[model samples]
Structures are given as C-alpha cells and as structure tokens.
Target chain A: MKPVYRFDGFIFASLIAGLILTIMPLPDAINAWRPAWPAMLVLYWTLHKPERFGLLGAWLVGIAMDTLTGTLLGQHALALMVIAFINLKLHLRIRVFPKGQQALAILMLVLVYEFLLFWVDGVAGFATSGIARWLPVLSSAALWLPVAALLKGAMVLARRA
Target chain B: MAGLKPTDVLPGRGPALGTRLFLLLACSILLMVLDSREDYLQYIHSKLNIVVYPIQAAVDLPFALADWASTSLASRRQLLAENRDLRRQQLRSDASVQKMIAIEAENARLRALMDTAALMTDRTMVTEIMAIDLNPYRRLLTINKGSSAGAYRGQALVDAFGIVGQISDLGPLSSQVLLISDPEHAVPVEINRNGLRTIAVGTGDAQILNLPFLPNNADIRLGDLLVTSGLGGVFPAGYPVAEVNQIEVNPSQPFAHVEAAPAAELDKVRELLLIWPGDVQDQ
Candidate 1:
C-alpha cells in the first residue's frame, strides 16, 4: 500500500521563502535578472505532489503574488494556474527524464508562464519594459537545477526528521 | 480484479482537472475585468496588503541593518565634517528662503490687488522609501507611509530637486508610488522659457520623457525647462518636471520628436515629500 500524502509544513515554509525572495530588492545592476522565484516554487510543489499542492494552491500563491507586486488583480493567478495545470498533466513523463531533459522541460514551462504574463499585460494595456521583461525567464531556467537539488535535499532531511 | 467495476479503474479526485481549470480561468477573467474597469477591488487589495506587510518588512530588515551599522560605525571626525558641511548648506538655504519670503509676500499682495484667489502653500510631509521591489516593467516605489499617515490616493510626491511621482496604491501602513517615468504616466508641462504647453509622457526609461504633441514649428529649444502647468489637477503648478534634452523637427512628420530628462532622480530617490494640494485639506 502507498503512504498517505498530506500537505506538509515543509512545503509551507518553502512557499513563504519563495514569497520573500520574489519581492526582495536587489541592486539595480542585476534587478532584471531576478528569477521568477514564486513560479518556480509553485512548479516544484505541483510536480512533486500534485495531489497535495494542485491548482488551487498555485492559484492562492499567485493571488498573494499579485497583491504583493501590485499587478492587475488575478494576473499572476491566471498565469500560475496554467503552469500548474500543465505540470499536473505531464509530471509523470517529465519526472522520469534525465536531469538535463528535465531542466529543458522546466525551461519551457517557465517560458510559457512568462508568455502568459506578457500576454495579460498587453491585453490590460500595461506597457512592459522591452527585452528586460523576458530576463527573469532565462534566470529562472538557469537556477532551476540548483533550486531543485536544494529542495530535494531539504525534503529528504524533513522526511528523516 | 475481475469483480472490480471499470469506472473505478482510475480513482477520481474531488473534481476533474479540466473542470477546475475552466472554473478558475473563468473566475480570474472576471476578476481582471472587474479590476481593470472599476475600483471595486481596491478595498480588497488594501485589506490584503496588511497580510503582506510582514513579508515586506522582513525583506527590508537587512538593508536597514546595514544602514544602521554604517551610520553607527562612522568616525567622529567624519561626522563632524559632515555636520560642518550641512551647517554651511543650511546657512545658504536660509538666506535664500529669507529672500523667498519677501518675494512671496509681494506676490500675494499683487494677487490680492488683481482680485485673484490666494495661492495656498502646500502642506508637506517626509516619507521614506521602502526597500521593496515592485513590478519591473513599471517604475513604482513603495513608500513607508499609508492611509494611516493621511496619505491619500493621487497625492503628489516630490524630492528636493523636483516632482517624483504620485501615490498609486494605498494600504494601511504603506503606499505604492507610480513614478513619472512609468510608460503609463503623463504630466501636463509648459516650457519655462516660452510657456508653450504640451503633455510629457513617460517612455519606459527612467531618464527620458516624450513630448509627443509638440508641432514641428513649435518654438521649443534644447535645454528648455519643463514645469507642471497645473492643468492635470494632480500635480501643482510651477514645479520643475524635466529638461528638454533632444528635439528632432522632421519636415515629413507633423509632430516633432522631443525628449526630456526628468529633473528628479526617479531611480535613486530614497526620501520623498508628499504634498497635499491647495484644494485638498491636509489631514
């Protein structure tokens, strides 16, 4: 019999950290390179435990993000919900892939997430900073490997504890 | 396995995936439409802002600590030199303010003679800029003041040098400022040299503002100073806004392509003065 899956404190802690990182101010030189921390964290939770942290969880996190960032209401929520849905459908196949292929898939997912945000901004008449708006997508993809490893280690530690 | 029903082959969750997605999508679209079209969501956003205050403060704590450390660790000699420099600067400004007081009195007397309404002095308060990163696409600042501090929406913000921005979103403990450098922002400005009025709009660059309505034959020169015209009713009159840096008068184009550098260091401002206009009584 499989063990029961529950929403754990570990996931809650990581999500809070992600929220903090998303709004943390950096030096202007590299501000554009700040990764989509919340999006990546949502992706991690959904991919690892879809039954526990599914579309509703992603939507809530996105709502918090929109409120924090002062974007048009529901903008981030919509983008993140779509990302969660895609991961829910493909987690099984993508999880089985090699590390490099998994990273590529994660990159595609982040790109889609950013594209949705861009589309929303365009439709809402919010002018986006040209080229600079796409920088986070690349940074998010590049940091995915290290973030995944760190989260995996933390999960193992939590399980042991 | 033979006895099990075919419908039970895959255990269904609370709701099907597609159904949930569609419901959530519909809800989000409704929210966006409501948010963009009206002010119905402002109250909810302001209330939700209280929940995120702690997160914003946590992110700001490190920077605050570093600033405190630097100030507390400064040597007495450096402090004394800084005090002396400030004293000299204060004396110079005091002399200028004395002259300004005289000029203001004479101007008010002249206005009274002309039977014009008295020019009311704006009430001002200092607010520190919170160290929080807002949307990168828009030039927004989160200041450490909110409705509790009597900061209302659409209040004008200015730095020592010039106008900075206006309050966009207000929470209970903090407010967000939409800088003049945002692409969506526009200010009515008149050239100080000629009083030729035009609207200066932000071009998504912190240093540049575009004046798109100026005719090619408009008597605007490079280095002309732009000041608020008071027509928009948001910003007060005669505050320096920008300085015209470039102008291209192309015969083919009806409107000249002109750009100006903002007078305020919009990207570097750490403290801002919130001004209540003459019409709005300061709380």
Candidate 2:
C-alpha cells in the first residue's frame, strides 16, 4: 500500500468499470485488441495513491478476473499483484516521469506481466505461447494513453473539489 | 496527461522491497503447485466463480438486452411464419418419435438380444448456454448448468441435432463445455450407412471434423452421415455426430485425410442436455 489517505469511491468505480469493459464481447480479430485495461487502471491507482488499493486489493481483483473469464485459477491474480507490487515500490519515481515516459514505463510493466503469464502458464504444463496471445500486450500499450489520461483528469478534478 | 497529483497520502511503504517481493514470489509458487498438482482446487474455482458471477452476468447483460430489444417489434407475419416453421419441425420430430417407439417395441420383443436386466437410466439436466468462447484456437462455452445441476467433469452434453460436446469444468452454477470442434477434443464415430468405425477429431471449426487414417481409396464419400459408434462408450449409440464433407487420398502420404461437418450446430445452440446412458452396463 502507498501513502494515500482517502476512500476515493470514484476510482474504485472506474476500476469496476474497467473490469466490466474487460469482459465485454470483443470481436475475435480485435479480441486480442482487448488490453489489460483493469490492470493498467489498478496500477495507476496503486502508484498515484498506494495506501488505498494495495497488493492485497490487486490479488483479490486478479482472482475475480480469472474466475470471471474462466482462465486457469490464480493466473491473472499472480500477474496483477506482481505488477501492482512493482508499481508501489517505484511510486515516487513513476510519478516524477513525464507523460510520454510514463506511458513507456506502463508498457514495460505490462510487458513484464505478460511475460510472467507466459512463464506461469508454461510451468503448469499448459501449451507454450502463441503469437496471437501477445496481441493484448500491444493493445495494452496503446490503452495506457487513455487510462493514464483519465486518472490524471480524475485527480485534477478531485483536487479542485 | 497533465493533472493534479494524488494528495490523499497514507504511509504504505511499511514492508521493505525485498520482503514484499519474497512474499509475492512465495505466494505465486504456492498457487502454481495448488493449480497443477492438486485437482481439488476445483472447489476454489467454483467458489470464486460464484463470487464473480455478477461480473459475468453484467457482461452478458448487454446481449440479453439486445435479445429482448430485438424481439419487441417482431411482426405478426414473422410470428405466423415461425409458427408454421415450428409446426413443420414438430411434425418432423414426431416421425422420429414414432421410429423410436417402434425400435423400443422391437427390442422388447427380441428380449434375447440383450437381457432386460434392470438397467437404470440416468437423469438428464437441461442447460442453457450463457456465453461462448470467441477464442478461435480454444473452443469452450460457458453453460448455465453446473455442479448445482449435477454436472460433472467429462459428462456428455448433446443437443437436439446430435452430440455437441462434454463438460470440461463444473463450476458452481455454470460449467464449461468443450465443443467437438475444439482442437483438443475427439469423438468416436461410425459411418451410419456402412458401420465403418473411425475417430473424428475436432478441426478447430464447429463445421468441420477430421477423420484420419482410412486406407487409400476407402469407401467414404461426400455427404455421408456419421453417428456415434458407442465403441468408446463415452457417448450413446446412434447419435448423429457429423457428415463426411470431403475425403482426400494422397498416395505418398499413406493416409487419407477425410473431413466432415459436425451435426450439432455450435454457433446456433441455445439449449443443451447433459445426459448419461440408461444402461449402466453398456456405459
């Protein structure tokens, strides 16, 4: 958990919304275009306000994702928590970066999450990585732009209020 | 991306970096073992699914809404046409029922064929599909019937047309069905007309199945209907499974690649039945 001290109902609502969008019916070709929206948003909150949504929150939400999508149990839970933990550790440095560089960092974090997924899946005797499976990471990279912008805007609005 | 920074700060950097990292790594490793070596995690899957059901139900809400909205203005002409169509379908089904009754009567008369030894029939649970897996490579569908409906792993699920697939996972109130067209699934079938047995494997398309290893110039043809042979005993005998669409014989390959279409319409299925054999002896 970070050093933030607020309930932030709006942020939690946005995270739920992101999870809803994650489960929506995306076309097969663009299905991989479905990014790690929930994870990215979770990371943004964990970094910007680490105290509220911490590693435990990430782990629970990840389990919910795996269950909702019927993936192998603990798959997304493990990946999400790892990424969230990393972000928490680098909370100060991540906030200092400019928008463009921050996006790059988010991309790298998502990349690590994807790699962990591939490795964990392989370890369990599941089939090796397929080329199409990586399409989400590319989509996740592109998705960072809007997600970051939304969080940035939300924080601004909160401050003004 | 310019905005005010987060101000509601709480001191969360309690655990050192190394400690959290070690805990995370340890937790993941434990999870991996539980997921792999231990099959009992099915209970965990079921409980978690119950927790996330609202999310799934929410995701499915739009489709349900769309379906509801689509039929609002269904015209009288369409209803009449559908009634006529359903009437004709009912008539066609009645004929099959008559044929089944006749077969039952004949079998009763020929009691010597198989003993009338108290074969208890297993009950069937009707299930509706909640959602289909759009993953082209992995053919899976979430069904409404689950452990609550007495659906178990490896139970056979069939439709009005023929065998669709079997239950792969038994969730709390929902289970995952692996369609016959999935790459990982295979069904034992026989040519209904000739009784030549062969294993039909999923070709990753609901419309196509691959029948491998019939000798060159074997007597299989286009439009030949294949039915379950009951050899593997997983499925009941004499259910339409597929129709041979194309058969290729390559002299150099030493094996004929025969392709067929599954009789069960995976794309259009709304309701399914989880059935077990009546005769436990045969099963």
TM of each candidate vs. truth: 0.93, 0.84
Candidate 2 lDDT score at position B135:
40
- The residue-by-residue lDDT of candidate 1 on B1-283, one tens digit each, is 3454444333255579999999999988998999898678889878988988887788778878998998999999999999999999999999999999899999999999999987778889899887555567688878889999998988899999888989888999988888898888999999999899999998768999999999999999999999999997999998999999999999999899999999999888788999987754456
Tell me model 1's lDDT, rounded to 2 decimals: 0.86
Model 2 regions more than 4 Å off: A1-8, A152-161, B1-13, B71-73, B107-125, B134-136, B212-219, B231-233, B251-255, B279-283
lDDT of 2: 0.77
What's the lDDT for all of these models?
0.86, 0.77
| Candidate 2 local lDDT, A1-161, one digit each (tens) | 22133346767677788778876766666876678877887788888767677776787777777766656667777898899888988989988998778888888898888787788767765455468667777777777878778778877786666
lDDT of 2 by residue, B1-283 (tens): 1242444234435566467767866776676677776476887778876876776677778877888876877898998999999999999999998997687677766775667543344557688777766344667888887887767788888888889998877787888888898877889889998998889998676788999867887788889999988777677677899988898888898879899988888778778989877734332
Instruction: Report chain A TM-scores, every model.
Output: 0.95, 0.88
Candidate 2, DockQ score (0 to 1): 0.37
Clash-forming residue pairs, model 2: A2-A50, A2-A51, A3-B9, A3-B10, A4-B8, A4-B9, A4-B10, A5-B8
